[model samples]
Target chain A: MLREVVVLGVGMHRFGKFPETSLRELAGEAGRRALKDAGVLPRQIQAAYFANALAGLLTGQESIRGQVALREVGVAGVPIVNVENACAGGATAFHQAVLAVGSGSCDVALAVGAEKMFVGDTGRTIQALAASADVELTHDMGLQFTAIYAMRIQKRLASGALTLRHLAEVTVKSHRHGCLNPYAQHQKEVTAEEVLASRPIAGPITLLMCSSVSDGAAAAVVCSAEAARGAPQPLVRVLASELRSGAFRSGAGEELSTAARTVRAAYEQAGVGPEEIDLVECHDATAPGELLYYEDLGFCKPGEAGRLLDEGATTIGGRIPFNPSGGLTSRGHPVGATGLAQIAEAVWQLRGQAGPRQVQGARVALTQNSGGWLEGDSAAGAAHLFAV
Target chain B: MTQGVFRSSTDGEGAPSLAGSRCRYCARVSFPARPICPWCGREDTEPVAVGRRGTIQASAVVYHAPIGFTAPYIVALVELAEGPVVFCPITGCLPDENAVPPGTPVELVVAPARAGGAPVFQFRPLGG
Candidate 1:
C-alpha cells in the first residue's frame, strides 16, 4: 500500500570549486531552480531534507545545518531534516524524501545536497574529510583509502584478472564521456601511457586514476502524482527507491553483493531488469569501483568489468550508458550533492533536456550510491529507479 | 623484542598478543574487537587471541608506501586454520605473488616494528 511518488523537477548548479559561494547560497540556487522547474513558488515546499557530510567538520557547524541552509532561501518554519551518510548523504536524503512522499506524509518535498570542499589546503582538507573513516583502526594500521584500495588492486592483479592497462582504460573512457559534459571537473582526456606515467599515490593506483575534491550542489522536487500533474511539465515517476546497510559491520566481505541486493530489490519493485535500464548514475569514487559495480550490478559477469571497459560497453554510446553525467571521476564528488545530481541527470535525460550527454529516449534510469567504509565494503548502500 | 604473544615486559615474554573478539552467539569472529556480532548484532562475544598460526588466503607485495608507512611491504589475508580471515602486514620477507600463494602455511612472529618502534605482529615461513 505504498503511495506513488513523482519527480516534478530536478536542478543543479554546475559542479566545480565555488569558493565564492557559501553552502546555503549554493543550496538556495538549486532549490530556487527546482521550484521554478516544478512551477511552484517558495511557499509550496512542505518540508526540506538537506544532505551534507563535511559541513560540521570543515565549517564547524555541527547541528541545525538544514535549518541554517534552507532558512536562508526564504523557506522557514518547515520541518528540516539533515542527513549525513558520508559520500552517500545526498542519495540518503533523497531516499528519506521518497519515503516521505511514498508514505503519504507530505505532498511536496525538497531534497538538497550541497558541499563546499575547497576552502583550504587541499591535502589537509582531504585528511579532515577522511576523519569520517574508521579513525581509530585506520590510524593504528596507518591505512588511507588509497592504501586500502591499492591493496585490493594488488591482490586483483596478483590473481591475473586485470592489468594496469585495464585500469587506464577505465579512466580513458570516463574522460571521453566527460569531454561532452561541460559541467565535469576534469574535461581533458588522457592516454593510457599518460595514466601509467602519472605519479603513484598508493601502490598501483596513480594520480590520473583518482578523483579530486570540489564543491557543488544538486536538488530535486518530489511530489505525489496528483501534485506533479499540476506542474509545468510531464513527470518522472519514482518507481522504486531502496537503501541497504553494510552486510559486514567490521572487516570486509560481501560489499559488492550488498549494492547488488539493493539493485535486485529495486528492479523487482520497479518490475524491470538490467536490460531495461537505459542509463545509470553510479558511485565511481575510483576507477576500480566502477568496474566492480558493473559486475556487482549484473550489467556484466564478475571479472568482466575490465573486459567491458576495454570493449567500450560503459561509454556514452554503449548498450547501457553509465555515468553519462561524467561520473565522480570527471564530474567531481562534492559529497552531499552527488546523489541528487545523479537524479538530476536522469531527470534531464527523461525530459530530453541534456544538451550533449543525454541518452536518447531514456525512459528508465538507475542511480547507485555507496556510503562510508565499513568492515570491507561501504557501510551504507542506496539505489533508486525512475521511469518517464 | 621478537614479537610473539607475550606477558608484561618485566615478565619478559615480549609484546602482548593481538587480541580479537569471537562470537559466542554463532561462532563468527572479528579482528580488533567488535562489541556486537556483525552477523546478528548480539552482545554475546568473548575476547580471544588467534593463536600464532594460520594459512595465507591472499597476499600482495607493496612497492609503494602507505600513509605513515614505508614501501616494500607485504599485506596478506590470512585465515586462521581454526577460523577467521584477517588482514595484516607481513614482515621479514617480500610477499611477492610467488613468495606466498593462497594456502601457504605461515607462523606468527613477534618483532619490533620499523627501527625499534612499537612491537607488532608479523608472519614468516613456518618451516623456515
Candidate 2:
C-alpha cells in the first residue's frame, strides 16, 4: 500500500524577468519560503530534486542544479537530483518527491524548479525553446510554440465554433485574474479590446495572449501525511499524479490526446472526475491552448469549450473556476518553475489563503501542464489533482 | 547548402514522386524516409516514393518568425493520402478562413526556402 503524500508547504518566487537576480537567488527564495512555511529546518530535508530547462544552454549551469540552488538555503549533504522535462520539469520533480516520500525513501523531500529564460536576445531565447520540438522537423519552420495553437485556433474559427473575440476574451479573463495574483508576471488587467490590439505573435494569439518568457522559481515540501500531522501549516494532500508523453504520431488527428490520457489516469488514481474539480490551474501557454484543454480534459464536452466560456464557467465566480492563478498567460510560464507554482496556487486556494482570487470553498483542484511539441501534439503532458 | 526533403524521382508514368519510406513489415508510409517505422517500430522499412497530393489537416500563421526568417508566413501540417503527416510551409498561403482552410487539397512542390534560397518542399493549393 502506498502512503499518502502531503504537501507541507509551497512557495513561489514571483514569475517575471529579473535580469539582476541570479538563478540561485530565485531558487533559494522559494525554497527558503517553502521550508519556513512547512516549519521545516533546512537540515531536515533528506533529499532534493531540482527542475529546470534551458539553463545549460543559457546559463551554463547544467548538472547538479538542485545542489547549487538548495545549498543557498543550507540544505547540504543530501542526495540532490536534477530533472528536465521541458515545461513539465517542475511537476516532474514534484512527482518524484511525492514518490520518494510515499515510498519511505525519504521522510522529507524538497522539489524546486527554477528557470532563467529570455537571456540576452530574442534569437537565443527562441533557439532555447525550440529544443522542446523535434528541431530536425520544426527548426526550419522559423516559428516556435505559438504556431501550433494558432493552427488549431484557425481551424476552430473556420468551423464557426470560435472568433477572434473569443480568443481575446480568454486573454482578458486571464489578465483580470492575474491582477488579483501578486505572484503573477503580468499583474495589470486589460480589456478584450486591448488584448485584440496587442501585437500579434501567431494567428489570433496576440502578444498578451502568450505566456511570458519568465525567470522564476518555485518549491514544494512533501512528506507522508503521518509525518505532516503536527506540522504548523496547512496540509494539502497529493491525491494523484499522472504523466503521459505524446504517443507515436500517426495521421489519427491533429490534436494529441496526452492531456486526455493523463487526466483519465489522474482521475482514476484520485477516484474523482472532472465534474468533481472545484477549480483549476492549467498550462495556458496561449488562449487557444486553454480552450483546447477544457475540451481535451473533459471539463466540458468536445467542441463545447466556446459554449462553456460563454456560460462564464471558468471565471472566478463561475461554477468551475479555471486558471484562478492567471495561468501561464498572466501568472507566467517559467518553464521549470511553472508546474510547482501551479501547485503552490492550488495549496493556497485550498488553505483559504488566496486573498482576492479565491474560489469559494475550493476543496479539490486540478492542474494540467503540457510541455514540448512534436507532430501536432505536446511531447510531454503532466496532470496533477490535489485535495485538502 | 540546403537539400530537398526527398530525393525525387520519376514514377512509372514519368511523373515526379516524393521519396519516402514504407514499413516492409507494416506498410505504413513515412515521408522523407525513416529506417524504422514510427507506428510499429519495425526495422524492415524500405524507401518508397509518395505522390504529392494531400489534404491540409492543420495550419498556422506565424506573425513572429525566428531569426533570419520573415514573419506572416503560413505553415500547415498536411496528411498525405498515402500515410504520415508532413508539417511544411505553404507558399503564399494565409490562415484565414477564406484561405488555406483545413481539408483544402494541396500538392507538394519544390520551392525556395529562405530569402537567399535553398531547395525545400513546400505545398500549394490544388484548387481555389
Best candidate according to lDDT? 2
CAPRI category for model 2: medium
- Model 2 chain A weakest 10-residue run by lDDT: A135-144
Measured by DockQ, the strongest candidate is 2
Q: Which stretches of candidate 2 lie over 4 Å from their true place?
A: A254-256, B1-5, B8-19, B31-36, B92-97, B110-112, B116-120
Runs with alpha carbons beyond 4 Å of true place in candidate 1: A249-256, B1-15, B34-36, B39-43, B51-82, B85-128
TM-score of each: 0.87, 0.93
TM-score of 1: 0.87
Tell me each candidate's i-RMS in Å: 5.2, 2.6
Local accuracy of candidate 1 as per-residue lDDT tens digits, A1-388:
1789999988877778888888888888887888888887778888889999988878888899988888655677888899998888898999998889888888899999998888766755666656666654343333356555665666667777788888888877777777787777888888989988988766677777776787888898899887776578778999989888866633334434568887888889899988989998888887666777888788988677778787777888788888888788888888888889888888888888888887888899999987777545677788999998
- Looking at model 2, the pairs that clash are none
lDDT of 2 by residue, B18-77 (tens): 678899888888865788898799889987878578888877777888777787788788
